[model samples]
Target: MNAFEINGGKPLRGEIIPQGAKNEALQVISAVLLTEEQVIISNVPDIKDVNKLIELLGDLGVRVEHLKKDTYSFQAKDIDLDFFMSEQFKAKGGSLRGSIMIVGPLLARFGKASIPKPGGDKIGRRRLDTHFLGFEKLGAKFNYNSKTNFFNVDASHLKGAYILLDEASVTGTANVIMAAVLAKGITTIYNAACEPYIQQLCKMLNRMGAKISGIGSNLLNIEGVEKLGGTEHRLLPDMIEIGSFIGLAAMTGSEITIKDVHYNELGIIPDIFKRMGIRLKLRGDDIYIPSQPHYEIDTFIDGSILTVADAPWPGFTPDLLSIVLVVATQAKGNVMIHQKMFESRLFFVDKLIDMGAQIILCDPHRATVMGLDKQVQLRGIEMTSPDIRAGVSLLIAALSASGRSIIHNIEQIERGYQDIDIRLRALGADIKRINTMPKQH
Candidate 1:
């Protein structure tokens, strides 16, 4: 296992570039299975989950070439259908949550797809009902093996239909969209997840000769195409990482500039941080956060306590609520963090409270943080990272604390962020990766 040894109280400076979007990479990479032609994708983040998915693709007979740093070309000309039923597939496919996405494209291209139960963060109940239900609506037969914990979908001919999704799930929407692209006739999807990642996938599909309308809206119309060709696509900078940087800057009182962040796509992120009293400026494509000794939380217009909550696209992303909650610990006022998406994400507050931050765990979905206002410096301690976002939040908290902190299970962090220690080190952060042996039972 790996851990992070961070000496807190060092204010990071210098400009840093955010990596390509992990979420976007997962969707687009899976879409490569939709077409057999060579598809080149640039700006892919070099992270654990993304790399794992790429490795899985290669094992499944996709010709994956590493063209350059953060660039890859995939040609799925000869997919081994037998591999899907092999034990190797179960072990590899079950490890990543994103692996479930391959079912859509495979079912569309090969008429059958099977996958073991997927894994990622242990946040909460992340149901796959939306995904299988969407596929069922598109004329695919779905089956589940409870004993093996596997899912299978088969379609002799996928015909389009009006699919009113039960929820606006981003992955579900992407999966259904991929399945519908090569389907027969037009497919109408209402209440679709229109995140920037989904929009990028739709655009990339269109570039590859897939007919998809409603680029930025909840209602998407996809006219089934006979086949799709290859196309080059570039991923946007990771919005979650950018938001984490902003929160890191404010919490550590650092003057930092984040480069090449697509500002237009980061809906409600900048505004939400701005409401927390962090002073930042937009310099062309970069975001500049100045050093601040004190930042106060804002209240509602009616003078009620400010609440930061997560919703679907066009609303605040649920991914950044953990970062926002961590950043609020040092602000001048209080704020309630409502994590509407996951039930267990707020449980990390106990670690923050142990470090002397004033936080009340209202429930599984909410936490009220009373800002310390620089009057008290958080004392560092040992902690374990539960998930990706919480791990990064604890890293930010460690960066702002006094003395030193050791964060175990840093693989969770590396699963999402690429070379985080290296990037933070460039910005003068006293953080390093340390190899640790597992404790004997």
Candidate 2:
């Protein structure tokens, strides 16, 4: 296993550019399978999850080319349908949750799709019932194989239908949209996820000759087309990374500029940080955070303690609540973090408490953090990362601690962030990557 040894208490200075959105890239790359022509995608993050999905594409005989750094072109003209039933796919497809999205495009173009049980962070119960239910709504036959643990969907002919999703699940909506784009009639999706990633997917599909309207709203209208053509798409900068940078600046007392953020699309992220009393300024397309000796948390107007929580789109994302909780540890007041989406995301606060942060885990979904206000610096300690968001949160906590900290299970971190150690080192962070071999009994 590999760990990061971070010597903290130094302010990071310089510019850091956010990588491409991981969620968006997954959906966009999956859409390439809908058409046989070459589809070029730019600004794709070279993270483990994405690389694993790309490898899965290669296993399916999709011709993938690396045109340049963070750019790739995919041609699915010669895809090997047999690969989906191979033992190799059973292993690879179950490795990442994003692998489940392949079912949409594969079913659209090949009339059949199957995926083994998907695996990702053990945050909570991430059910695929939303996905399979959507497929069943579109006249597809859905079956599950208990022995192989695979969910299979087959459709001799797909006809569009009205789908009212149980929840606005992002991946579910994307998968259903991909399937609907090549159906035989109009498909109307109500209560769909309207995240920027989903909006981008709808726009890209439109560019590829699929007629999709209501790009930024919860109700989407997709007109089925006979076929789709190749089109080039560019991914948006990762909003989660940008939010992490904001927290890092406040926690480490750093002056950092996050470059090329699509600020207009980042609905309430900036304002949310501002509520935490972090000083942020917009410079063109960049977010500049100056060094601060102390940041204070704001209370509600009626004199109640401040609370930050996550919701669906146009609201705070559940992904950044961990970052927000970590940043609140050093603020000059108290704040309540409500992680509405995932039940177990706040469990990592116990590790932060071991490092001298004042946190009260109210339950599986709520935490109350009493900020230190720079009265005392957090002392470093050895810990293990739990999930992607929590891993980055721990890294931020380690960066601001008074002494050296060791974090294990860094693979969780690498699955999302691209070259994180190198990027932080460029900003003067004292982080080192070390691999340790297990001891024999």
Candidate 3:
């Protein structure tokens, strides 16, 4: 196991660049299965989940070549449909929630797809109903064996049709788009997710000759192309990582700049973070957060506490709520954080509560965080990272605390944040990464 020992109360000072978006890369990489031509993708973060997906793709007969440390070329010219391998994939599917995206493309192109229950954050039951429903509209049938937790999909010659997804799920939207890109006719998807990450996928597909219209809108029209050709694409910087860095700088009372942020892609990130009373000058696409001694949450004109909630595209992202929640802890006011998308996402609030912050857990999906408002400084304690976002949240909490803190299960953090300890350490963060075993207690 891996863990981070952080010496708290140290202010981070330095400039940092965010890594590529893990969520985007996951879905984009899976889309490679739709073609038999070589696709060169750059700006790929070398994280655990991406590495795992690459390994999984390689094991499934895709040839993945590393052009550079953070760039790769993939060609799924040949794929072996072994039932055992498909079952193994399903068993690990939830590990990277994005892996489910391959189901639609695989069924459409290869006639069948089997992936065991994919693993990811245990925040809630993220249903694949919308994904399967969209796939069904394109001529796919699904069956599941509860005993083995196996999911299998089969379809022959996906037919283009209108698909209205139940919810604008990011993954579900990508799944249908991937499948419909090569359907027998034109496909229309309404209520489609238009996140920048999804837009990137749509653009990449367009580059490879897919007739996709409405690049950045909720309604997408894709005319089926017989095949997709090889293309080169670069991933946008990870907005989640950018948000995490903003939280890190604010909590540590540090001055730091984030480079190459792709601000155009960050539709509402700047405004969302502003709700916590932070406003930074944008130097081109870079953002520089200055150190503030006393950060305050922006209050309403009527003097009532404000709430920060996440929603579908054009709104704040649900993934960054954990980071925002941690930032609210140090801010000088009360703000309620409503994480409407996931059930267990607020489980990390208990850790903040342990650190002398006041947070009322309304339920599995919401928390009313009464900010310390820079009055009560949190004391350091040992922490275990439960998930990717939570791990980073704990790290932020630890760095802003009064003493030393040890964070275990750091691999969860590594699954998303690339060279996290090294990067933070460069910014004056006193963090050490080490392998851990049971201590004689």
Candidate 4:
């Protein structure tokens, strides 16, 4: 494992290029299983989860060839469904929520599919009901084995029907859409997850010659294609990384500019952060974050404390909540951070509070942060990462602390941020990445 040692209280000031979107890449890579044709995806981020997923796909018998640093071409001409149905399946694909998506597409195409329990951020209980609900509506029978932690979906010539998801579960919507894209008849997904992730998946499917209507809307009408052929598509820039950078610049009191961000693709992220008293300059496709010597949270019209919350698309991303929560600690005023998607997410505030941050954990999903305390600063200390987002948040907190800090479990941080230590060090942050060994007993 690797750990980051950060000497804090340093202002990070430099131009940082955001990496490719991890969430979008996860779904885009899985889209390869939809066709055996050669699919070339570019601008891919080099991260643990993405690499692990690529490894899982390789295990599935997909011919994955690296074209360049951030580009790869894959052809699933030799997809072995049995690879995903083994005991190893429980330890492999079931560990990633994205891998579970393979089941729906495989079942629709091969008439049978098996997947182990899916894994991702252990933020909270994110169920696959919406996904299975979509599968059942598409004429597939799901046999979930709790003991084996596998889902066996079998069906012959799936007949599409009206499919409405319970929630806009991102992966669920993706899995359902993948299955329905090649069904016998029309499939309608109501109240679907239309985030950038789902949008990119729909676009990739469309580029591959699948008839999917409502590219950016909740009602997705996937007209089952006879067969999807391979077509090349570029992965979207990592918007979450972009947002994370925005928060990082604000907290560091640095005037940093982000280059090559598709401003239009970001929806309302720029405007939402403005509510936190973070002003950004959007010129063409780039974003400029100016240094704020006295950063503060903006109050509501009636003088109530500002509250930053996350919602579906056209709203702030839940992934960036941890970053924003840390940023709020340095802002001038108080603001409540509400993360409805995950419960364990807000638990990291205790670690922040230990560093002298005035964060009141109202509950499992909400935290009230009183910033700066007029004369207080977060001091650096040694800490362990609990999850990916929290790990990155701790890194940000460590950078802003008064002294040196050591962060363990950097693999969690690496799972999302691509070359994060190098990227942050470029911005004048004294961060060093070193491989660590467990203490011998």
Candidate 5:
């Protein structure tokens, strides 16, 4: 296994660019399957998950070409539908959660789609109910094979209809929107996810001749067309990464500038950090974080303690809560970190507690963190990363702690962040990547 050996207590400095949005890349890449013409995408993050998806696409006969770094052209004129039923797909398709999204475009264009049980971070139960139900709403037949652990959706003629999602699930909305764009009628989606990723997807589809309205709201109207054409799209900078860097700068007392953040699309992220007393300066399209020796958490106007929590779009993203919680460990005052969306995400706080931070794990969803207030420095310790976000959060913690720290299972971090060690090294972080085998006793 590979691990990161980090020498902590050194502040990172210099400018780092946030990678293209991983989540958006997944959604947009799947959208390429909707058109037989060439769909060119730029700003694609070269990460493990995305590369895996691209391999899957190539396996299905999509003409994939690397035009340049961070840019690619995909044409699915000769798809191999038989590949979906092959044993190879059974192994590969089940390895990534993004593989499930291919069902939408395939069902839209080819009238049928199938995928093995999708796998992702074990943060919590990520159900595919929304995607399947939305497909059924648009005149598709859904079935699950218990014997093979696969999902199948078929629709010979899709006629769009109204869909009100249980939750504004981002991938679900994207799947249904992709399907609806080529359906027979109008599809109205209420309670839809309006995150920047979804907005970009809508805009890209519109450019490809799909009629979609209500770009940045909870309700979206899509008019089905006969076919979609090729279009070019560029992904937004990853907001989660930007948020992580902000927390990293504060925790390690580093002066850092995150370049090309696409600031207007950051929603409530910057304001949320401001609530934790971290100062941020917006310069054109970048975010500059000055070195902070100490930052005090804010209290509510009613004299109540501050609570940082995750919500749907336009609210704090659940993906960044781990970074926020870790940063809170060194801030002044106490705050409650509530991870309502995922039950198991807050369990990582136990690792922070082991490093001499004061944290009370109230339950699976809530934790009360009493900040160290820069009065004490955390001592580095060995730990294993449980998920992508948690891995980066631990890396940030290690960078701000004293002594040496080793992080195992760094592959989880690489699944999302592209060239993380190289990027962090550019910012003067004392981190080294190493491979090791377990010692036999």
Candidate 6:
């Protein structure tokens, strides 16, 4: 296993650029399968999950060309549908959660697709009912084999229909949109996820000849096109990474600048950090976080304790709650973190507690953190990374803590953050990657 050894208490400096959106890349790259013509995508992050999806595409006979660094051209002119039945496909496709996305485009264009139970961070029970229900609404036949944990979908003729999602799931919306774009008639998706990534997907699909309206709202209308043409797309900067950097800067008391952040699309992230009293500035498109000796959390106007909860787009994102929780550890006041979407996300607070931060894990979904206000510095200890967000949260805590710390299962962090050690190194972070040897029996 690979681990990160971090020497803490040193503040990071210099400018850092956020990586291309991993979530957006997954959606847009999967959309390439909708067209037989070449589709070029830029700003694709060189991370494990995205690379695994690209490899799966190549394995399915999609002509993939690495045009340049972070740019690729894909043409699914001769997709080998037969490969879906191969053991190779089973092994590769089942390994990535994003691999489930390829199913929509494959079903839309070629009339059928199958994927084994997709794998990803063990945060919670992420149900696939939304995707399948949306597909079935678009006239697709769905089947799940409990014996093999495989899902198969097929639609000889997809006819668009109105769909009110049980929840505004981003990936589910993307999948349904991809399927409905090629169906006959109009598809109205109500209570849809309208995050910037979803809007980007809809905009890219429109450029590829899809008729989609309501770009940035919960309601979307898509009119089916016979076939889509190729289009080039550039992914937005990863807002999650940007948020992480903001937390990193605040936790370490580092005056750092994050470049090319696409400010307007950040939603409530900046405001949320500001609520924590982390002083930041918006210069052009960059976020400049000044070194803070002490930051305080803001209570509600009624003097109640501050509560930060995750909601859909236009609301605080659940992904950044971990960072917020970590940043709150050193702030001047107390705040409650309500992770409504995922129950197990707040469990990582135990690691933070071990590091000498004052945190109360109230339950599976709630944690109340009392900031030490820099009066007490967190002393590091060995820990295992539980998930992607939690891993980076621990990394940020380690960077700001007093002693040396070792974090195992860094692969979770690498799955999302690109060249994290190298990037933090550019900003003068005392962190390095090390391979741990297997235990000898």
Instruction: Name the candidate, 1 or 3, with the larger TM-score value.
Output: 1
Candidate 3 local lDDT, 1-441, one digit each (tens) = 777888889787888989989989988999898899999999999998888888888878899999998899999998878833554665556466667877876876787788777787666788989899999999888898898877878887789999988999998999999999989898999999999989999999999889999989999999998988889989999999999998888888889999999988888888878879776779987999988887779877898988888999899998889999999988888888998988888998887898898999998877888788778899887777778998899999999999888888787788889998999889988889778752332
Q: Residues 1-441, candidate 1, lDDT per residue (tens digit)?
A: 789999999888999999999999999999999998999999999999999999999999999999999999999999999998999999999999999989889988888899999999999999999999999998999889999988988888999999999999999999999999999999999999999999999999999999999999999999999999999999999999999999999999999999999999999999999999999999999999999899999999999999999999999999999999999999999999999999999998999999999999988999999999989999898889999999999999999999999899999999999999999999999998888764332
**RMSD after CA superposition, every candidate:** 1.1, 1.5, 1.7, 1.8, 1.2, 1.4
Candidate 6 segments exceeding 4 Å error: 437-441
lDDT of 5 by residue, 54-150 (tens): 9999999999999999999999999999898999999999999899889899999999999999998989999899999999999999899999998
When summed lDDT is taken over every stretch of 10 residues in candidate 1, the lowest stretch is 432-441
- Put down candidate 4 lDDT per residue, 1-441, tens digits, no spaces: 778889988887878888888888887888888888999999999998888889888988999999999999999889877676577666877667667766766876788888877887778887878877788888888888988888888878788789878888888888888888889889988998888778888988998888899988999988898888897878778888888888888777788899999888888788767877888998777899988777668888999988888898777788888988998898888999999988899888878988889999999989999898336778987787878889888888888788988888777788888999888888999999777764332
Compose the digit string of candidate 2's lDDT tens values, residues 76-116.
99989888789999999988999998999988888998899
Instruction: Identify the candidate with maximal lDDT.
Output: 1
* Order of candidate numbers by lDDT, starting with the best: 1, 6, 2, 5, 3, 4
Model 5: lDDT of residue 246: 96
- Candidate 3's C-alpha runs over 4 A off are 83-95, 437-441
- Model 5: lDDT to the true structure: 0.93
Query: What are the lDDT scores of the predictions, listed in order?
Result: 0.95, 0.94, 0.87, 0.84, 0.93, 0.94
Regions of candidate 5 where Cα sits further than 4 Å from its true position:
438-441
Worst 10 residues of 3 by lDDT: 83-92
Candidate 4 local lDDT, residue 59: 88
Which 10 consecutive residues of model 2 have the lowest summed lDDT?
432-441
Residue 208 Cα positional deviation in candidate 6, in Å, after optimal superposition:
0.7
Better of 4 and 5 by TM-score: 5
- Model 6 error, position 224 (Å): 0.4
Worst 10-residue lDDT window for candidate 4 reads: 432-441
